[model samples]
Target: MKISCSISFEQGLGERLMFFKRRIEKKTYDKSSKKPVIKSSICNGEQVAGFKDIATGAFEEIMLIKNQDDLVEFKEIYGISEEIEKIY
Candidate 1:
C-alpha cells in the first residue's frame, strides 16, 4: 500500500501561517527614549508605524499601516496604549 499527501498553497493558508509567525515573534524598544509614532509620506500618503527617538528625532520602521487591523497588531505587539503621533 502507498499513500501520498499534497498541500496546496493557493488557499489562504499562507496568510494564516504568516499571521501565526507574526503573533509568535515579539519585539521591544526603549520606552524611556522611544515613543510610538506613525510616519506618513507627504507625496504618496504612505504610513509606517514605528518608534521614534525622543532626543534624536530618529524613527525606526516596524510595520506598514495598511488598515486598522495592522495598526491594532502593531499596538498589541509593542504594548502601546497611548495615542500615537503622526509625522509627515
Candidate 2:
C-alpha cells in the first residue's frame, strides 16, 4: 500500500514563489530632512503612514495603516525606532 500527500509539487512551488514575491526589501529615507508621521483623517478616521518634510511641511505617503501589523511593517521597512507624530 502507498500513501500520497494532497498538495502537488506545482502547488508547493507556487507557494514558495509567492513567499519570495511578497518578501519586503529594506528601504531608507532622509533622516535629516524628513520624519515619520501618521496622517489621520478628521472625519473618516483613515490613517496613512509616511514621512513628512520637516521644513516645508510636505507629506509623502508610503502605505495605508489599516491595522497594527501594517504600521509595524512600515516602521520595520524604514528602520524607524522613534515615536511617530500624528497630524490631522
Candidate 3:
C-alpha cells in the first residue's frame, strides 16, 4: 500500500530527503530536480504515512499495525521517541 502525505514547507527538497534518509533505512532518490523520493512498500498492513519538518521540511509516515507485538517491536527497532527529532 502506498500512502501519500502532503509536504508542508517551502525549502530545498534535497534537505527534506536527507532528513528521512538518516532516519529510515530506505532508498531515496532525486528525480529531475524535483523533491527527493523515499520509496518503500506496504506489506502486512504497514505504510509510510508522510513526513514533518518546517525549517528543512517535515512530515510524518503512518503505518497500520495488525498486531500489538509488531507495533512494540517496531517502536523498539526504530527507536521512536518524542524527544527524537530528524534534521537535515
The TM-scores of all predictions, comma-separated, are 0.71, 0.74, 0.24
Scored against the true structure, residue 21 in model 3 reaches a CA lDDT of 25
* Order by TM-score, highest first: 2, 1, 3
The per-residue C-alpha lDDT of model 2 at residue 17 equals 26
Candidate 1 per-residue lDDT over residues 47-69, each given as its tens digit: 99998899999899989999998
Q: Judged by lDDT against the true structure, how good is candidate 1?
A: 0.85
Q: Give the residue spans of candidate 2 off by over 4 A.
A: 1-22
Global lDDT of model 2:
0.88
TM-score of 2: 0.74
lDDT of each: 0.85, 0.88, 0.40
**Cα miss at 86, model 1 (Å)?**
0.4
Best-performing candidate as measured by TM-score = 2
| Model 1's TM-score against the true structure | 0.71
Which 10 residues in a row give candidate 3 its minimum summed lDDT? 30-39
Flag the better candidate by TM-score, 1 or 2. Answer: 2
State the lDDT of candidate 3 residue by residue for 1-88, as single tens digits: 9999876445676433323423344333232332321224554333332334334554445444455544444454444433333222
